[model samples]
Target chain A: MSELAIQTKDISMSYGDHVALDQLTLNIEYGEVFGFLGHNGAGKTTTVNILTTLLKPTHGKAWVCGFDVVSDSLNARRQIGYVPENVHLYEAMTAQENLRFLGQLSGVEDLQKTIDETLELLDCKDLANRRVGTFSKGQRQRIGLAQAILHRPKVLFLDEPASGLDPMGMKMLRDLIVKLNAELKMTIFMNTHLIGEVAKTCTSIGVLNQGKLVHKDTLKNVMDRFGDDETLERLYLSLNTQKVA
Target chain B: MFASRYIMTAALRANLRDQTVLLIAGLFIVLVLISAYLGWSATATVQDVYLKVVEAYAAKGQIAPPNPVPDTPPLGLLRNMATYVALIGALAGLVLGNKTVSGDRKSGVYALLASRPITSSGIALGKILAIIIAITGLLGVAALTNVITFMILPNFSLSADEWFRLAQFYIASDLYVISFGLLGAFFAITSRSEAKSLMIPVTIWLTVTFIIPQLTANVLPMAALNPLKAMAPAPSGAFFVFTQSVLTPISFAEAYRALAATLLDFAPPGFKFQSFISPMLTLMIVNGLLISAVVVAFGKMDASRSAYDD
Candidate 1:
């Protein structure tokens, strides 16, 4: 109902003495493919965790689909789906079984029909009955995407879903993300350190450096300012350099 | 509360498909049958020996050798299954439960499962329900096989009282078996590694099964159902009596063996259901607490945090 599908204000997270995310604030409109860019330990996943209502923020507030991340977490969870990094799911079970389990949790109706449709949509219909244990990494990613989209979430959160995939797998995932956003009218929040993937897939980008968001803007606007893809890298390095300075 | 059917069924399917569960369950069946066969053959041998001696006396030998003590109540002849329940049945349950959380970790599904709309308590309950089904199904089959074997063996038909006692014995066995399962699950979900979690339950199982038997007085083969064997030392001082009274309730294996013995009519020294009720209650309470602990542990876990202790 809100103009933004995801929103956060001055959220900070700490584990004992160390802070993983700090005063991070951002918002994404209903249909943007927002790419979260940061190196390891840059708080990208932490931010994704907060917005997905998985972790409560130590300071500030977050809202997913107009539900408070802490207070209205269940409703927030219902409105979003997550695919974590290195997500190997129910290897002993077939893809259909995995879908049934997660589908029921999401309260989907007619799970079997929906699963068929999802697999068809993702071009994984043939692999539906195969045990996930036998699946290649790329095939598992397809299943992951299928499950996340099974309930038709308003916002899908992906944590480095492209990290370890083969080149073809990455391309298929890219096309799938684009298709889900365009055809399903869904919003996407993708966490990645891979800027090239962002250039190819994400429309909006935010770069986090050392637990803080150092820069954020529309890709086109960023390209105009920096002049090219190579300068985008230069800009990112300069931002991290400024933080360390 | 979301429907746990999906999760519960998945877990049960995994349990059913697991080779270790199958192997342990198979071994339990074999041992139970072997124990029954041994009891039946031993009873037959005693009867045959007595008859032969009696026939010799009639042919002009001295009076037949005094008859060996006959096994009484007929139900006592069937108690080998009880001991199996205490050991193998418990291990079967233990093996099923210890893998629940660890299974998720190994399959890389905990993060995925935790992210769903369901509460962690719901997830924990689903897992517990699956274990309950797996263990019950396993032990139920073992019980059924024993009953069938008893019917087939000559001179081993069950009377009404024997049937009731047999049922009671199994209830006790099921309770004992489930407790170990819960204990193993507790460690699996709480600990950081498989080897560490595994060692805890097995160590306790070994301690309860073997070491404690050595330490107790009735330490004999058939009479030490209550392993404390503390009665003899009690005459020495009030301290021994007090200690026995305190420690008896904590010995689950002893409690189960004692309970099963009384129900089966072995009635080890001064055996009465009333005396063992406290220990049975302890077993029941411990099981309830373990199931609740699993639910609470999962509920309190920080799902938002990436990765498990594993």
Candidate 2:
């Protein structure tokens, strides 16, 4: 078993009577692109929030990069980069300025160089000087990706990273995720419902339904169990329906 | 250190971007100008009243007038302007301070800033510094305007002592306003909505600056038992009787009498004390307590909690 970059043991979160995440246990290995597949309100964002140290778990424990998510949050935050579902950037600021601000907060040394490289990596060098408010959704998503990877974090928690992007933009993001995983050897923990993107990018996948991880396996294992004849979407539906029965 | 500087810069930028701040500054300038004009007029009225009273006494052929004629000069106009300018400075401080924290919450900028690595105290202090800079800039302009207006006025002559007194009053009044305004900001930061935050400060200002002072002036028996009167108690041969009559919860009245006796050149014997404390000491202590309370409340607030959440 490779070293686990993220480990959660029976972690649970509740907002009053609503259970956002219920005793969810997950382990993601280093350098693996793990796709978290779930419908809306399936606790994917909540799990990502907990792993990124944006939120505290109501119960159980979570660790990222060998530091407790709650007790050693500063270390955990330093180790992981987070891209929220919506690419919320300061609209008034230029792409370069936005990246610089986030980079500084992340304690990135050689901030200017990092911003340049990240912008170039996202193929957004031309738009760097333009205000982000003028950018398209795809451009904003790219900028969001650049900010997330600027600090060279060990793990990246991308909550719907391809959301609101056009087909071409989605393809570009898929390619970028693969490149990050293969070349950088960085763990990508992505939450998405786009099975096509998952099929292309992720090596391992987990299916979450109603705050429970119903399936966790490699693409090969999932294909073998459900057969290559059937699509992953159909297999996911059947599995979920079976659970309902 | 760099983070604090960055935060301060960001706060200043936000203030500049806010249209409401600009509007408030414009209104404050108008108020200052109007008040300055009114002050000039009021001082002219005082001069006319003095002249009339002197004329009335002259008709009686009294060689030595009971009251000296009040001087009407540019110096007096400047002094009047200074008083109105101080009030304007206080209003500016209050408006800026109340807006600093509450405005952030209303604009949703507080949440964005809180998501960063900065603490609540840092954010609060940065905002306070921004408002201070804004208020100081506005007051500087008003002061310059006052100086120019004084230079244009006829017979305007302000000695160094007069200028210093005006400056002293401005500093003290601005500090007092900022302190209370910060307290209001703290309240706004912890309140559910901006309306409540604004209301609390306005209510406190009305009570402390207007209502309480009026109540103290009218209800406080110290005025009737003037210290000057106590110094001349022997005119009625009732020194001991007057002292006993004035001895109750109105110790301040007696203290004022003692103070007058000490300051009066013709005060009788046996009324002097070796050591005397001024009432300004009590005011200083009260101001210190209010400021400390505001600082403590500001320090304890959590930047992460939304205004509606609180």
Candidate 3:
């Protein structure tokens, strides 16, 4: 297996004249909880799209689990799962039904068994028969995570997963992300602008500015240099302001 | 490739579980049963009247007219069954199509679907297979309803040819229904927003089912149920040519209507399907092309970004 779970080489994406991701090179190793931070339209979702093989980058190459996203897209697709923001899945379907449908699509063997185990692991075994439409945002987010990891994918991509969550919801999500990383040894690529959530959940972080990646570092290394999460926030804000100036 | 089967199975379950589809199907079955009962009641009335006439003739010691009025077409008992399938069945089909692949698209589930090992074409094919299964199941109910009516009617009996023709009518009905389904799927996938997608198919449905039929029935007042009337060559005129050329193609529903009229043996005496083959083939080809277009559209889709499903 390649040491890296995700690798991008000078990747850029442009929509007409609007540049989304600018010649970005990035590397994330297996089992790393990667928090990709950016303002709106700063290419966080775009990067997630490219990594998940949902969109192809215009100017460069990307690989997931050593499979080129464009060329070996099917193989790369097999190695990953994605949960987009506010993805209220098949609202009419029960939790088990939705997971069964997705798990089968993901080609998980023994799907019913997998669904039972996955729901249990996500702490929602009792809610399995309830319709997703009835669940709160935090409960739905947990179900969303369950679906993403149903196939035991090598890497999982979540785009602004905590966007609509309350404080308790956010804390629950952080704990869930940590549990997934520890128990499954799964690499997680989360896109978020919340510095607190990032400091709590992500092991490594990358900050992007105006479509360009401006900073990349391990959370431990950054905290050692900056002293604390608040100092890191100040550093992030100052960098954005400097770019603006 | 294996995922294709799973997708197909899931799609079938999802389609079957859909409440709207089930409701439409239930309504269709009730309508079919009512139609069958009406046919049965008519059969009893006709038999009772015949027995009275025979008894009267025997008492008077007069010669009977030697006329046995046979219900010429076997399945003619449920003649309105065709229209029901075309109208109600097409609605069911449209519902099925809109909710299958496009449901996932609107709900943002296709992003996860795209992340799976299945190819886009595979997923589309799976849904297509599900549509076929759903349509077939519906048509089977229609056929069974009519067939049971045939077995129970006292004086009515089905000839071998009539049996074959009844089956043929259903096959054509399946084609007619699926064309609308393809239309529904196409619009569902390509429309800019979920709310707007339904309008395109509904407009087409209204035009094809009610509007076009009414127009054609006005032009050829008995076009739907009457046997084709043999006529001389058209006069050299613009209106005649447009009616014969432009309007006929757009009124593809008439193709099924005419074909059903012939199979039910209600065609004007001496009318052969040879004259109607062109229209039927045209409808089939047009339907085939539309389904292929939807498949190609799916092939080119950016699975990551949905077209505003909700």
| Per-model TM-score versus the true fold | 0.91, 0.71, 0.91
Per-residue lDDT for B63 in model 1? 82
How do the residues A71-168 of candidate 2 rate in per-residue lDDT, one tens digit apiece? 87667777777777777676667888778776776668999998998887778899899998798988888887888888888898899998888899
The residue ranges of model 1 lying beyond 4 angstroms of the native Cα positions read A228-230, A243-245, B46-71, B211-239, B272-277, B304-310
| Superior candidate under DockQ, 1 versus 2 | 1
lDDT of 3 by residue, B103-220 (tens): 7777677777788888888877777777777778888887898888888887677878889889888888888888877777788788768867778898888777656554433225
Model 1 over residues A1-245: C-alpha lDDT tens digits? 88889999999999899999999989899999999888899998889888877677899999988989888877888899898887768878899989988899889998899999999999999998899989998998899999999999999999998988988889999999999999998899999977778989999988898888888889898788776655666766776666521
Residues B1-310 of candidate 1 have per-residue lDDT tens digits of 4557777888888876778777887898788878777877877887787788899897995787666634456777766676678778888778888875667755667777777787778888888888887777777877786687677665567889889888878788888888888887888777766787788998988777665543342233333333233223223455544545655556667677767777777655674432345656877988899999999988776665424445
- Note the Cα lDDT for every prediction shown: 0.79, 0.65, 0.79
Q: Give the Cα-based TM-score of candidate 3 against the true structure.
A: 0.91
Q: DockQ for each of the predicted structures, in order? A: 0.71, 0.18, 0.74
Error of 2 at B22 (Å): 1.6
* Cα distance off (Å), candidate 1, residue B39: 2.8
lDDT (C-alpha) at residue B113 in model 2:
48
* DockQ for candidate 3, C-alpha atoms: 0.74
Stretches off by above 4 angstroms in model 3 are: A224-230, A243-245, B209-236, B246-251, B272-280, B307-310
